[model samples]
Target: MSTPVQLYIYDLSNGLAGQLSLMLTGRQIDGIWHTSIVVFGKEIFYGQGIMITQPGKSHHGSPLRIVDMGETAIDEDTFNEYLSAMREQYTADKYHPLEFNCNSFTNDCMGFLTGGSIPPYVTSLPSDFLSTSFGQALQPQIDALFTGRPPSGAPARITPSAATPDPALAASILQSVTAQATMGGPGPSNGILSMPPAPPVAPAPVPPAPSLPAPDASLVSPMHITTNPASFHNLLSSHRAVVAFFTSATCAPCRMIEPVFGELAKSKSKPDGGVGFAQIDLSVGLGGALAAEYQVHVTPTFLFFLDGSKTHELKGVNAPELRTQVDLLIYEAFPPHAHMSLSLSALEAIPLDPILFSQIPNLDTMFTKLAGFIDGVTAWNGAVTQAQVKQTLTRTVLPFLKASTATSPAQPPMASFDHWPTLTSSLIANLQLSELFPLVDIWRIALLNASFSAWNATKKVQEGPLNRFMDKALQAGDVPRNYLLTVLRMLANAFSNQVLAREVILFTRERVTKLLVDALLHDDVTVKNAAASLGFNIAAYLQKQRIDKVKARDDSQSAEENEEWETEIIVAILNAVERETNSEVTVHRLVACLGLLLRLSPYTAQVTSLLEALDAQRVLKGKLEKGGCREGGVGKKDVRRLILEVADKLCPDMAMAM
Candidate 1:
């Protein structure tokens, strides 16, 4: 085993000194030292010290004297036991070596070092020597022992560095030695020293006590309430005005009112010292039962009590109203000498009526006029910019409708297309006399009319508006799904505004994609159509963009460029055709999108799982088509000519092959 390191000690406390004495001597001190040992409690503190031994003097009349061991372990059980014994055996009146030399010496030394008084020694000691002398002489020996190796055997004392004894310094030396021995000793005893047992330990500290809750003023008097229900009735009987506000954590409105209630409680005083406020959070245990008893359906219910009796109940109070109600309650309970009237005209300055749609009767007329304008542009083979359309819808259509509906008692014209004509007639008649008509609606009307003028020329005047009206009516949400589907089919067949047509198709596709993705796991046929529509539109758009890009490129390019361009063109056309006819396309829309990309741009084949999809549609379609009646087939000659025509329109380079 390694030699024990020496420890130096200084600045000894009386308790530490007594503890050290008990630890070293295996004996209890009496009176002062014993008291000191108990007073200092334990050695769980950090500090510094030195040790030295005197060559020719006895330490505290002990045959063997030891000094400090600067940083060394100690036998904790032996030390604790010894100190405990000293405390138990020593009396307050008797002065013995244990008390005088151990206890008094420890006390006085500590007092000198720590600037505190030495406690009186209660233990009897031998008559000639002063307590101070023993400490002073022992100091050097204590420092020396700590400076050198610690003692090897059980309860053995070792002196490290030798010092000449001065009577004045002897007391300090002895105290220092005691402190060192207590603080720095051999490791905790391994049952070697037989000493008295230690007392039972005190219980551990509990967590911090809960704080008292603040008073709540939202509850009305007469209602008995307490977070502790057993005491609730007692509290209510004592109070004249009692108010209970039931609240919860999740309620936003409840949280908002908490601070306001707290403020009210602080500002108001109880009349006859009988008013009381209580608030209960419904989130805690047993809160649900209490809530049920109070019939608290919603949060922040303020129940009022008058003279410990239930009075009025208020629900959902705003801050200002709550303050006013509380003030009124207070005034009623404790009336003032003067009465003051309050005027609320200033508070009522802002309008509070909700705007309803039926009030705007001309709204449908406005929409019709706008739709008419759109029709005119479509007829004229003209394009109406998105900005112009959105502006017309917001400024003209929405406002007119709001106004017309605002004046009517009947259900708003928006409910169905039946009232749209009445709304449209009013708008046209109003517009006919106004100059704003030419600047706004006319310009848009001219654009759309020009776009579709040739197609609608043979059609009658009333036919245009009637058709548009029918289309809008069909698209109305109140219409049955099958009827809406029929209308959509009719619109597709009748209209030739390819841009609008394409956009409508895209919109349908996106909606279908969402529905299909949500219900795909169910294996529904409706889901399949939706997925197919989405895939078809995506492939169509890809083909369109590819063709547009190709057509825009200059024809004065190299052969290699032309070949690459041809390949791209071929790929795009093939993808569109395949996507239109392929039943296997009924998978995830994203997968279908990836497949379209891969077919159009096969060079990206390294991207695995890009074209993978769960397609059961091919098998289903085969079964369906097999069961359908066979139709008349076109001759090869006519088919070849049709193919050639399609090739010429799409890829001129591939026309020869067809």
Candidate 2:
């Protein structure tokens, strides 16, 4: 008789991945899948190498779902021979979380047995994860774990009879029951093939642990009352570090330190910190049970839990001691990233704040420049309307700039200037590419006002005044150097306002990155410097988000979607760093940009690879050896110091070894 073959699908994530992957990865990943092939009344899977058990009776217990993989005519002896050959390729040490694992072996087996492949979702999962930014960022750590090391712990075993090893099998059965309770029964089953019963033997080795819940930053709140035992356990499980305050309703000491506790929660309550605070009143529901469980018999007692175990205790109303312990708890829970060990003082001093073009030009002279350009452009004959724009700038914008930019103790509020948007839009729409620079410079200063930038950012992407002007400049192609410099400076100023930073720079990063990359290669030194400033803004924004995500434990899509555009930007900066001979200022800014791109990047391997491919270390060493770069001048030491910092401190270990 032809034997039935089935694909047993187990969710190693226990269904949590389906619930959380969308929120965490910005993509809907159903599960961390593990699959095995069942044929000839035996279940086979690969983890610590190939292993077999009775059908649907492995340590995975019941599969999350099963698929009819069609029947295989291959006899038991031939199948066992195929398995023996497969074991050589799918050895314990050959396991990679992404590249080679259980699914890989099942797909191979399915191909041979039924001339079919594993479900595409099952097979494509790793590639899909590797495609995401978080995956790219985390690839280095994951790669390091499974690369060359021998698979540790228990080895694979074969169960010729219908049997499975103990405790592990029992636990797996319990887990399946729990999953069924929570997630409903297995996926639509096409009649499960039955096999002869056999005695349950010693338990199988423990399966790998599931991915944990992300330390919810929102949980880092003040010690709120948690009455239910299950809710309290969930709270502890959600955070890496937690503080529980035990108190009676009438305890005076608890009241004394209550404010202090609230303050501590407020101060240290950050998502990246992974610290949570809870209050348990001895007088209330389940509080007595929790107190008795942890052996807390006294009022106003504070218990600190680290990784779900009570590690320390304090019994007092002393605020200082409480503060000290909480600080220590947070420090222990979230250790600094390895990248923090580098000596990067020079690089650290490079300000991440936006470089603003806040220089207020002579309004009359600027207007004169614009009027002259307007008269010259045959395409723009709206001289009267253009004059009104100039009038509006002098009347409304000039005073706002003068007042807002003042150094007085109390500054006047920014005027509504409701007509400024209309006037600027009309001016931008009417002006030719050459005539746009003077008007753009005026708008650039206006962007320094929060109100103007807010209005600019909120407009439709294509309809924004800055967008319209930049589009014109991009379309014109061979623009004058002056226009490029002014436009670049305007972009730098856009970064000064958060709204513009998001909407203009970050939201339009593709177009802005392309423009900056091309401008970095411009022949004009001033334009290159301006482009470097804008590039610094982009890099700074990305790096800030990168660090914030690291600190907040945010695994969602980071600042840039993928490293392609960022790599393109970095390569352009590297080229700028290599080719520049005259200006150390340009070189300093370019090096800073490069440092920000590489520092704490999730793609350290990729960056190191790029640096090697471009021979960047040699180029930077050459810059260091250059006499002008080494020579004495204002901030020349900083220029040289930053170059060394980028080379010695920021380059990955692989690059350093090279």
Candidate 3:
């Protein structure tokens, strides 16, 4: 009656349809076909519909089947309501829009029409019934199902539009949502429900890598000095103790003791953590005169300054004793609170100003009359027993000596002299004494062959009253040639007086000339080498004076005598230079000798003889070409310049010859 509703069903894949056939037939599906459109093995359904038969005549082979029911047509409003209810259910299940087959729609439509009951005609429906034209036209309905709001107060749909959201506005909204979520509130938007997932964001940029820590200053001693000397005074005025070093790179002893002093500087305690260490390199012209004023003959030397004044000295350091001495000096400068009584006693014994006292302190009187004892030792002379000497030195000098020795860790063990002769001789000459002349002469000769241990035993005595007793020891004729030369060497360096240096030079020149001439003929290599080296230094010293014109004129010595002395000294130096075997010493002596001859001697005969000897040896020419006179006659141009200058002054006519 209602144009017989056609139904079509389609299987997308053959395997799925076979599975459906087994479910429908209650028989295991095998490969078999029943109808062209509903093949038995291929066409499969699970009781989806039924076929109904009616009273009719067959036109061909089988009877026609019909399925009819009363009032099968549905009204538009009711259909709309039914579609809305169906969409609402699907929406709640998160189903999206999709095309539907005719069979499926018809089945649903039949169910709604029959109030959810299936009819007998459903069994007659073919598997291909859903592929008919009616199924293809349902795309609009499928799309609308997802696009519009559903019935029963369902939420409205959110469609994706062509217009893109503003990135800034979207970011702001996201930030607000994140903040709310962090605070335990409902999120700002419901994008978490149906929104497309956003691409992951990279983490925020990391800060720059941390830098390495600086080095620790506490581990090593720090050298400190103000640009102004007054600043040192200012620092000392406020601090209890300030340590200072007078050092020189040229001083071997100073180089050795630097580390020990550095350690002491780091370890020493400061009452208010205000103590400091300062250093001055006398070799660099910072404080040579100041060093001399403090009688700092040898380095490395340290002076302990307390309250802007020098309180103690540490001198002549070697390695093994450095740490102990440093500890002592630091303790002396800044003692622990409990040791103040002992420290005061020790302080009282040490003269507030040692330079003001002519003599060193004595053990017995040191405690009660320290200044008077110091003054008494300046002029007093008693024949001290060896034990007494040892005791006095241990008490008075050992502390400072120990401190100085502690500053250098690399120094060799102290060389001992068995007797006091050698050290005493040196001390006598250094003191420039004439009263102890006889004793000085005897000791000088005895020291030449004395053992080192014997010599060390006498060091304290020699450095004491005897130091002032033999001022003229260098002038004593009974003194051995080697010993006199040695004494002269000590005197030349120890005293700052130019007059004393000149006297030492005169004495050394006379004795060294005799030794050199004798050593030249001697077969002993050691003796010859010693003479050569000695001659080199003496010649170098004289040459420096001649070049600088530092010598004072003497009216007593005639011009002829002076000329003869100069000629003799030059001849001796040239002989040593020719005979010397050690290349280093030979070269040094040769240059010094040549420089002296070029500056001082006016005798043309002596000059020609010296030049002939140098030329025969080829020493000067070889040195110029090979060594280049930057040091020790290496550079030809410099040598030629010096030669020409000397020639011009000595023999103007022989300038071209040089």
**Which candidate comes out best when scored by lDDT?**
2
**lDDT of predicted model 1:** 0.35
Model 1 lDDT per residue over 1-658, tens place: 1112211122233344354434432344321222221122222111111111222111211222123212213244533443333332222212222212233323322322232322222212211112233333333333343333233311123222223222223234343434433332222232212222222222222222222122222211112113324234444554566667777768889888977876666456352345656665565323455577767788888877676666677788588877767766655554431111222222122122211111112445645655555444422222434345546556544543353334352323222223223333433333322222322222123213223323333334233332432333333244333322222223322223444334333333333233323323223433333433433344444434443443343224321122333333333323333333223323223223333333323233322221112121222122223221122222234322323322222122322323
- Candidate 3, 128-238: lDDT as tens digits: 222222212222222343334355322222221112122222222222222211121122232122222222222222222222123222322223422123334444664
Residue 449 CA displacement from its true place in model 1, Å: 75
- Candidate 1 or 2, higher lDDT? 2
Question: Could you tell which candidate, 1 or 2, scores higher by TM-score?
Answer: 2
Model 2 reaches what TM-score against the true structure? 0.52
Give Cα-based local distance difference scores for all models. 0.35, 0.68, 0.37
- TM-scores, all candidates, are 0.19, 0.52, 0.25
Candidate 2, run of 10 with poorest lDDT = 155-164
TM-score of 1: 0.19
For residue 550, model 1's alpha carbon misses the true position, in angstroms, by: 90
Candidates sorted by TM-score, best first: 2, 3, 1
Ranking by lDDT: 2, 3, 1
